[model samples]
Target: MLIRILFFLAFLFLIDWYSFQAFKASFPGNFWVKLAFWSFSIIVYLFVAYTFLTFSNRGVSSPNFGRMASLLILSIIPKLIILTFLFGEDILRVSTGAFQSIAGSREGDFLPDRRKFLNQTALALAAIPFVGILHGVLIGKYRYRVIRHTLEFDDLPEEFDGFTITQISDIHSGSFDDRKKLEYGVDLINQQGSDVILFTGDLVNNRSEEMEPWIETFKKLHAPLGKYSILGNHDYGDYMSWPSQEAKAANLQHLFQIQEELGFKLLRNESVQIQKGNSSIDLIGVENWGKGFAQYGDLAKAAANLTKESFKILMSHDPSHFDEEVKSFAHHIHLTLSGHTHGMQFGIEIPGFIKWSPASLRYPKWAGLYEELGRYLHVNRGFGFLAFPGRVGIWPEITVLELRRK
Candidate 1:
């Protein structure tokens, strides 16, 4: 944490220095420019100090208000500073680039053009802040917006083809500091008329108890078929310090019970055949099986009793599991669904450059639908977030997969 703080400070210093340089170049490095720069620096420092002071005492009655306030201020400061520097740099770069281009052509005198170049660069730099503000607003509103969409797959088997399976993964129930907000999300999920529901994993952030308030609310999500779930990394209490080994084990056990209470059939390396009329498909849910995480997800064990002749749909928490092991496990699995990535809570689904969340660097199949080695994998971006507590480009997802036949 200390290292992180120091790194952040260094980053701020770099941006500030660059902005100062850009301003100097733009304004001829004279007294007015220097004075203006110093004045701005002092004002920014005092503003930050005042923010910290108020942040040091967030609310009159809230016990942890100070910490909360500090966090909020800390989170906003970097963006503020970055915006300032960007504005300065943009102006400088554009002006300089234009001046250089004109000078090279020998179409005009160089000095006036150079000054124009500098001012243009400064203008370009200033545009960065405006862009940052626009991005922040868009991301802030879009990230947190609750979205519900129903998707139908034409390749699903005829029997379960129209089977409306609603999925919500990476709920990170523990992350919600507000009960009302959580309840609202839960209510939204319950509203979907899903025939069956599958919770891909990471139900809680870390602690099993963190999911207490959500269990009952989630139980309201009922289907004629059933509600099923699998484990994500956080469900194992791996990130936090527990009292003892027994406590950790107990938390996991309690989590399973919570799944049961939520009316979900917790599938840990197991398979169950769900019959619809005369036909049936195997629903396999395995433990966390991904790169650098839990290696206990046994596809072989999960599909042991199931036959390859039957169509199979799998619920595995991490998408990388499909990449690393699913294809060779058996030909039984036709579709695999996962949700640990949360698309890093940010991403852009643009053509050609579909930049996924930061999690994509770790796991390539970060979000939405993906196919590899003839096997299909659907990576749900996730229904919640982790440390940042904001969705940004990626919104909370309640996937409605309508299985269809080819």
Candidate 2:
């Protein structure tokens, strides 16, 4: 742990020192700028070192850890951007130095002078994310967007056509500190007036009790039909240490009870039939089942006695499960709802122009709706932020899905 911390600090120092070169290039010989630059850099480094040195197993439940992570992101991302350009500049400098040394110039003075325009351009570009991240921490995370999507299916129950369902995932209640902002999010969900509300998972980050404070606020979410939820990996409390197996088991049970109190029919590898008129559709929910995550969910058991012809909507936390397992199941699942990947909590998403995030490299279907083999999967970006404590371009989402019979 200590070695890793030292390595991280070393990396930060390099980024800081290299970035300072640009500062000097841009403001050549400005003593005050140099002092302020190094002063801020040293303070950030010291604070980061202290944070990692004093780290504990408080896990995701600790707000301090989240705050520290946010600070690091805000500090490092812009610097990394600056480093990108600076690195290119260094390549040119080194190449010039090599050529000058071959021509008999003194080795130390071989490199050419810093290009002010190049350094200024890098600084200007880096400033974008710096201000953006600052705004993300202050306001973007609380910025809730309601996405309305209509999915059409030939087999959709006629009665259920136009049936609207609101979906939100990854609440991570432990990470919530602002009651007013949280209440506003909940109120926004209520304002959608979807027939039924479905929460894909991650109600809390590590412990069940983390939801204690926000239970009432979330309870305000009203759906005409009912509210339903399933477990996410974090809801299992597997990320944290427990005194005993019994304690962990009790914690899970307590979470279930909390969901019950909040009026969510917590589904644990089970299926429920939603009846409308004479027709009904199966809403099967499984425990956290993903390729790299916990596999407590039993799909066969959840789909027991359900026919392949029956239209089914699945609620699984991780999108990997949809790609890895749910797609090829003997019993066809028409639609799957998931939200494990939080778009890495940062990305540039433009409705039709471009939608990109670092998370796409890992999970192709990281967010939004996708179609495969006539089946549909909608991955909610998430209703809350996690470790970083702030979301950049990908704002908190409240999805309203309407089913259309074709």
Candidate 3:
């Protein structure tokens, strides 16, 4: 691990050195600009290394690390964009030098002179993402958008034709730095006036206590029917270190209690009935199940008594579960609610014209609604940010799903 980290840092240092050349090329005479540039660059790199080296043992739990991680991300991304232009120009310069050698011409230098205009252009282009990364860290993560999706199904219970379910997933409370912003998100969920609220999981990042400070804030969310929740991979305390097996078990049990305090019925491989008038539908929930992550969910167990005829809505934290099992399950789960992807915390999503996220490469059903084999899945983008501590075009989502009988 230490060797890998050192190699990674060395790569970053190379980029830092290369990008600084662009600064020099653009501002040849401004000594102050160069001084300030190196000063900020060195400080950021040192802080990143210091945080990793000093806090690796107690890192995830520290509030300071989250800020440091975000700062590192903001710095690295723009620098990478700058690296792209600089690297591309260098490639062209090499090709030109090779061509001059073949033609037997003596040049001032083996490679052509680096153009000031290109360097200036690179800096200008880099500023776009520099500002974007800065904004994403500051405002985009908190900029919540309510996505309304109406799903029509032939087998939907008539009583549930207009049943509205507001779903939020991946709270990652450990990453939250602002209470007011989260409270505002909670308020937005309540304002939707949905019949019931379903949180598909990831109530906290790595530990249950992370959700303690915001328990009261989230308790404010209300639904006419009730609020239902299921566990995500992070809720199991797998990402952080624990003293003993018993302590890890206790941490999970504490998370169950925390969910109860917030008026959520945490379902673990279980099913409950949501009754309306003379009709009812199965609301089944399973533990976190993914291809690479924990496979704690048992679909057969969760749908033990139910059959394919039942009008069912399932909650599984990871969308990978849908493609792997749920879509072809004998019980035929009609709709699956999930949020583990978080759209990779970055992407370009423009609805119809373009909807692309790095997460899609991993999760086929990364965000919004997807249908296959006559079964449906709605992958909530996420209610909160994760490791990156910010969102790009794929902003945090509050999914409002209205079930309709067709």
Computed on alpha carbons, the lDDT of every model, listed in order, comes to 0.69, 0.90, 0.88
lDDT of 2 by residue, 1-406 (tens): 8898789889888888989899999998899999987787777777777777777666645777777777788778888988999899889999988988998997678888889999999999999998988888899899999999998999898999899999999999988879999999999999999888999999999899999998889888888788999999999889988899999999999999999999999888999998888999999999999887789989899999798899899999999998898989999899999998989889999988999999999998999999998889999999998888888999999999999999
Candidate 1 residue lDDT tens string, 89-112:
567657776787766845453323
Tell me how far the alpha carbon of residue 238 in candidate 1 is from the true structure, in angstroms, after superposition: 1.1
Q: Estimate each model's TM-score.
A: 0.73, 0.95, 0.95
- Comparing 1 with 3 on TM-score, the higher-scoring candidate is 3
Model 2 Cα shift for residue 79 (angstroms):
1.6
RMSD of every candidate to native, in Å, equals 7.0, 1.8, 1.9
Ranking by lDDT: 2, 3, 1
- Which residue pairs show backbone clashes in model 2? none
